[model samples]
Target: MSKVKIAVIGCGSIAQHRHLPEYAMNEHVEIVAVCDIVEERVNKVASEYGVIAYTNYEELLADPEIEAVSVCTPNYLHAPISIAALEAGKHVLCEKPMATSSEEAMNMIEAAKKSNKKLMIGHNQRFVASHQKARKLIEDGELGKIYSFRTAFGHGGPEGWSVDGKESWFFKKNEAFIGAMGDLGVHKTDLLRFLLGEEFVEVGAFIETSAKENADVDDTAVCILRTESGIIGTLAASWSYVSKEDNSTVIYGEKAILRLEEDPVHNLILQYKNGEVVKCELGGIQTNEEGGQTTSHVISHFVQSIISDTIPPVPGEEGMKSLQVILAALESKETSKIITIN
Candidate 1:
């Protein structure tokens, strides 16, 4: 097991831009195969990497040569494909919004445990340099008792990013389950939990499909969240930012405020109550725009975990917890009430 052989299950935007490239860069990983329903896309990627192409993920999983796989397919297929891969005795690195529901998420976790395989979720926001720094500062008491926060992730929509453009599964409710909330909101929920070291206890949201016409799924959502420690905040996800991407988080504390990815020059900024400001030029966060292909560190981390036989940084259980917040937000939108997380 010197070089863990791995395959990517979906040859879409995520696999192309993140998983495949990162895995290829990691010395401890060997790209064995790439799977996608689209024959041309899979073959092109396979040819580019000189690896095998698989139109059926089950066939890829049965190869036995592949020790791990990245599930980058549609939202609806995440659970089933991951569960199958785990059952087939392959470690899994699933993308964010792990599943459409808590039951499916728990099932995936159960499969990983039953098969004694690794199941890491791809919530790369926590791996951002600024985000990691913010977590450290909070942990070291730099931001004395956090009070409130506001985080947002907005872009020009997946039509520009997904390989299928406007016809991508992202705009389909059955395929994607939820829209902006599932695509972008879950990332914030996971990141908030990592930075604050707490779970969200309640959520109330207004999820709507106002921006993209002819789409049944939501394109914009605003959620109010309360942590277990009583810290309240707002989380927003939108696909209507026509001008530029806005991936920023502002955490207000008793003594200072921490802003992440909010500046063009500095990725992190700290403002103290004493009228002092500190700007940090930590590397840029990955964006959908050109030249925004910053390394996400997810694939590298996953490979390291598999090689070391250690639990992945963003394990299935952590993914499920993060996903619960989005599920609660969806419920809140439907009920028009604040939903409490169990």
Candidate 2:
């Protein structure tokens, strides 16, 4: 098979760290171009990869040889750029919080259907080694009759990770829509859905902008989520972990309790009711901290799905389902009532 000619639509930190590098590592991928509103960033990335650079995404999409693209732009641009790329006969791998609203997400899905192209969202949490193993164990009845869980993803802030630092689009409501919840919370929601293999039916949340100054969006959020099977859990996303990052989940079940990313050496641990403790040294998850840049496996999976003409692991419909939970959480925060998913 010929290499899949690809382009990255935004030369942001995610594009620089994850998408661009991962795509280059894939033997079946050929990066044809890069696009970003910032000419310097785009040019630097294109030069590093020996590819063409364009400041306009529409112009980049006009190239007939580009087979796919990774949309690493701000949250507000995910749906529109992904929809346009799909309509232009190209596969799309858009970043998380796929859209600002459920309607936009649905529109992107419809566009993909109309174009008959694969649309994968960049929900990398589902691709983590520990997460995948946890899902498999639950599926194999290792943790029989799951009861509750507490999952959190928090860090110092995006100021350290994003290209623009403190002034990044992440703090701007017009660009990011929601702050920590959209940036980090959605990943936990998607992962919980994947691990439990059920949909979240209700949400009650408290979202606040208590941490970061000069930021109009929330910096911390805590949500109560109930799955369709009546399994309830707490999900927390924050940008105020000053000293270290916390990306961990603990699940309780009738047979045993499962812990993911909780211990430094052991990525997964299970303690049974009969005094048996099992520790698995699965690989660490990717994080913003030093020495945490492990392979995400998202780019490779997206590339393989396109090459094999198969559905991606996290398709647009799946992304929309996970996104709806966040949307419901927002509504719950506003109305001070438990919001039910339709």
Report lDDT (Cα) of residue 283, candidate 2: 81
lDDT tens digits, residue span 276-335, model 2? 999999888998778996588999999999989999999999999999999999999999
Candidate 1, poorest ten consecutive residues by summed lDDT:
286-295
Q: How do the residues 1-342 of candidate 1 rate in per-residue lDDT, one tens digit apiece?
A: 478999999999999998998998898889999999999999999999999999998899889889999999999999999999999999999998999999999999999999999999999999999999999999999999999999999998999999999999999999999999999999999999999999999999999988999689999999999999999999999999889899999999999999999999899999999999999998899887888856999988898898888999999999999999999999999999999999
Candidate 2 Cα deviation (angstroms), residue 75: 0.5
Cα TM-score of candidate 2: 0.99
Residue ranges of candidate 1 with Cα displaced over 4 Å: none
For model 2, what is the C-alpha lDDT against the true structure? 0.95
